[model samples]
Target: MKVRAITGFFFVIVMLGSVLLGPYVFSVFYLILTSFCLFEFYKLVREGGFKPSRESGLINGFLIFLFFAAQCYFPAWKFIFFLPVCLSAVYIQELYKKTPAPFSNLGFTFLGILLAVVPFLFFHAMAFMNGSENFNSHIPLGFLVMLWSNDTGAYLAGRAFGRTKLFERHSPKKTWEGFFGGVIISAVAGLIFSHYYTELTWQQWVTVAVLISCFGTLGDLVESMFKRSINVKDSGGILPGHGGLLDRFDGLLLAAPIVYAYLYFISN
Candidate 1:
């Protein structure tokens, strides 16, 4: 247990520090994250009684990821229009092949992109999400701090006084007590960083906090549902105590887009 704690702490510092560095560093983080997440997601699909072409899935998934990367690195709003094109390409390519009953090769391919590629884009989007003036100089770093506050509060409170379940059916590990604790912690963090993001009102900042805590949990549950459906303990072995890439970012996947949307719509 002590060893796990030490290892987990070190891992968090390195990962968070790299992520906090900047957009260029963040892009590299997302690429590696998307790649490993795709690998773990494919593992889940195979477990669910569908055998997809590993080479095809990885290739197609990475290509879709490239589209997202382009949108971020090059600033292409047309990339949003490209989603259907990419989805269709993946579907048609997979459906053409032979497979067994309930064998929707296209379905697995589509799911992979949705789960793996889509969320991966948000991290990049958040980094580069601002217009010229409204851009928070500390955007990526501030965003991650909000998320970490959520997790930290949830973990400490949950350990101290978590008993009732949050969503017992989907995720046995979550507790309602911890959920509320995370929300409170995130709100506090949002308030703290409210100055850095001068674009938002206190109310808007508070809303962001609530969304981060609540939707963050939703994202966690979504991944938990995926893991449960496939009967796996962790998504991968990339992070020490965090389990996998998916495990670490499960909450942030939904939270990132939301944080982006808040800035995009309200402030911009």
Candidate 2:
């Protein structure tokens, strides 16, 4: 517990710093994060007796991230044309390889990028959604705040009052009581954030909080499912006492994209 707490403390500092510091720092930090997560995904799949195109996938994934980031800050739509070309490289490169399951490799390669990289790009989109050219950290920062609150609430509540299992097959420790506790805590945090941020109304913030509670839990289960399939206990040992990057950010994976889509449709 001590080691986990120490690791989480510094990890929170870097994450908040990335947003609060500046856009350049935010961009660079997520770029490295996206790349690392993609690498980890490919590594995980490799353990499942499949070979994904690690090099091509990482390159294209980075390019795709740049594409979305460019759309947020730059004026050129022409750059998006390059995405197809990069994707094609993934397929074309498979032809020269000796693997019999080339298409399987191709599919997993794309899946890794889609699953790990694209959502983060949507997260980058959030920082600029308020129509200001400068990157505003409040929206993204509020998101992390609520996610952490939900996790903390769930942990405490589960330890104190957990009974019925939420998803025993995938994650046995999760409880319905804990889940609702997280929702209530995140909802309250969302209301508080709306008071200060003001970028979104309180109702919208609460809705975002609900989405995070439901979908973030799903994200965590999905990552656990992946590890279970591979018969591994943790995704990787990259973060001591915390499992891996995937283990830490699994909630953000599905939640960010879904939240971005929600905010996008409502704004439109």
Which candidate comes out best when scored by lDDT? 2
| Candidate 1 global CA lDDT score | 0.73
lDDT of 2 by residue, 144-257 (tens): 999998998888889999999999999999999999999999999999999998889999999999998899999999989988988888888888899889998999989999
Please give, for residues 1-268, the per-residue lDDT of candidate 1 as tens digits.
Answer: 7766887788778767666676566667677778788787777778777765556667767766676666554666665675566546555655666676334655676677677777767656665655422323365666667778888898888888999998999988789899899999988888877776665666777788888888889999998888887788888777666687788788877887777777778745
What are the runs in model 2 whose C-alpha is more than 4 Å off?
A: none
Count: clashes, candidate 2: 0
Clashing pairs in 2: none
RMSD (Å) of each candidate, 1 decimal: 3.0, 1.2
* TM-score of every candidate relative to the true structure: 0.84, 0.96
In TM-score terms, candidate 1 sits at 0.84
Clashing pairs in 1: none
List residue ranges in candidate 1 displaced over 4 A.
Answer: 72-96, 132-137, 196-199
The lDDT values for all models are 0.73, 0.90
